[model samples]
Target: MRYRALLAFLAAIVAGLMVVSLLVGPAGVGPVAGIAALVDGKGALGLVMREIRLPRALLGAMVGGALGVSGAAMQGFLRNPLAEPGLIGISSSSALGAVIALQSGFAAVSVLALPGAALAGAVVAVALILMLAGPRGPSLTLILAGVAISALAGSFTSLVLNLSPNPFAVTEIVFWMLGSLSDRSMQHVAMAAPFMAVGALLLAPLGRGLDALTLGEDAAEAMGVRLTRLRLMLVLGTAALVGSAVAVAGAIGFVGLVVPHILRPFVGARPSRLLAASALGGAAMLLSADIAVRIIAPERDLKLGVLTAIIGAPFFLHLIWRTRGQIA
Candidate 1:
């Protein structure tokens, strides 16, 4: 009963924020006006509501939920409090693919080029991780493999930036790295949603396996849990969610790390309960941040990723501070 109530409350927060996100844009449309325009879809205001604000709001919720759930799943699978989605290198690799597309001028050829390249990169990274980790390798092996992939991808991205000759391309790449939802279309929402939905399906059922894992591997296996399959699903699902999100939003940081951490206690530290709650909390956090960026600097083009980093970095430091004793 208590858990159900908590889910309801979080869902309510997400819903409220979604509405606020649609209404609170640069156009300054009121609640009633935004709703009417959204429904009517006839005039300029209607176009703005349908084409611009709607997708932005939808992506905000979707991206946030993806990152949040991915983070929670990673932490649960690894049995580590600090685990996050990006630790597996999917986000960086996706960024690398996008960078390659932009640098090579492929992104200009088609609307799907950017995200397609990003997803391809994520797939390569995951394949490499799996190969390096091996099917029966321990959690430590997976961590090391992911770290290696992340460093390699980061270096490659930097190399692309350093060698690029076009000043315009460089500038565009830099801004894209910072991330934003401005100027996003429904096409982007469509591109990312199916992957996120599939990823969610892959992950949502892992609750029981993850809960069994809390008792340790041998015990979990004894209880009919298949550790090998669990690991594979976790990697693929995380890749799908984080890959699709980064493909659309660029490299928004700390969402996966922060949301799950904040909501863990509320869910009694159970991976099963944490997944859903974290998803809701994440959506609220991102939507609120998106709205805040517009309000705080309406004149300036504030990047969503930059704002999240600013908010997340301090919290990350605080987390480290609190866990210092444990680290030592």
Candidate 2:
């Protein structure tokens, strides 16, 4: 009953947030105006609502779902709830790829440059981590390798920005790093949706493997789970999801981290249940954060990542404190 109530509440919140995302923005589109525009031959309002707000909100759902499920997968596979896409360097590497594309002027040529570079970077990051950490290796070692990769990728991005002759690289990098759902178009959504959807399909079935993995790799292998194949699939799938997300929304952190952790208690630490629940929780959290970003500063507007980090950082510390004696 408690879980059902919580789920219902979350559902309500997400639905309300999505509506808010559609209605509220720079243009004054109130409920009546929005509805009239939708049903009647209104001015630019309906187009704005459809082309801009609709796609942005949809992308938010996808990206959040991707992050949440990926986080669940990472935690379930490692039996460590703290694992996240950012911590594993996939996001940073994807950002580096994006930066490379922008700096090389490919991003300016077409939107494909951005996602293409990002996906390639994501694939590279996962491949490098696999090599460095070894196939089906220690979770801790895998995490450490991820950290090193993040550091390297971050430095590379910084170096690229510094070296780029384009004077706008600094501000552009800031926007990309800060993360935003505003000003997004349907084209961006079209570019990333396939990768995100495909990645989800690839990772969803691995939930059972993740459940078996909680019993230790030896036990999982004894149960006939293919550790090597599972690891490869996880790495690739996470890269695809994280890459598409970062490619579009930039490095919006902690959705993956927070959602799964928040729902883990309800799901009883079971990986399979946790994955879908986290996806729902993540979508709720992200959509809510996005709505908050709009209303919190109706004048100048805050970036989505700013809201997420402000909220997520404190929760992160609390998590570290709470989980201190357990995982660390």
**Maximum-TM-score candidate:** 1
> Which ten residues in a row are the worst by lDDT in model 2?
34-43
How would you encode candidate 2's per-residue C-alpha lDDT over 1-328 as one tens digit per residue?
6656766776676677777777877888888778667566357887887788888788878788888889989888878766886777899999998888877778888767787888889889988998998886767787899899999999998898777777787678777788888888888889898998888888988987899998999999999999888887887788888888998888898899888887887877788888878877888888888888888897775899889989998998888788779764
lDDT tens digits, residue span 254-300, model 1: 99999988888788889989999989988998999899898999989
In candidate 2 the C-alpha lDDT for residue 34 amounts to 82
Best by lDDT: 1
Q: What is the TM-score of each candidate against the true structure?
A: 0.97, 0.90
Among all windows of 10 consecutive residues in model 1, the one with the lowest summed lDDT is 318-327
C-alpha root-mean-square deviation, each candidate:
1.5, 2.5
Alpha-carbon error at 279 in model 2, in Å? 0.7
Clashing pairs in 1: none
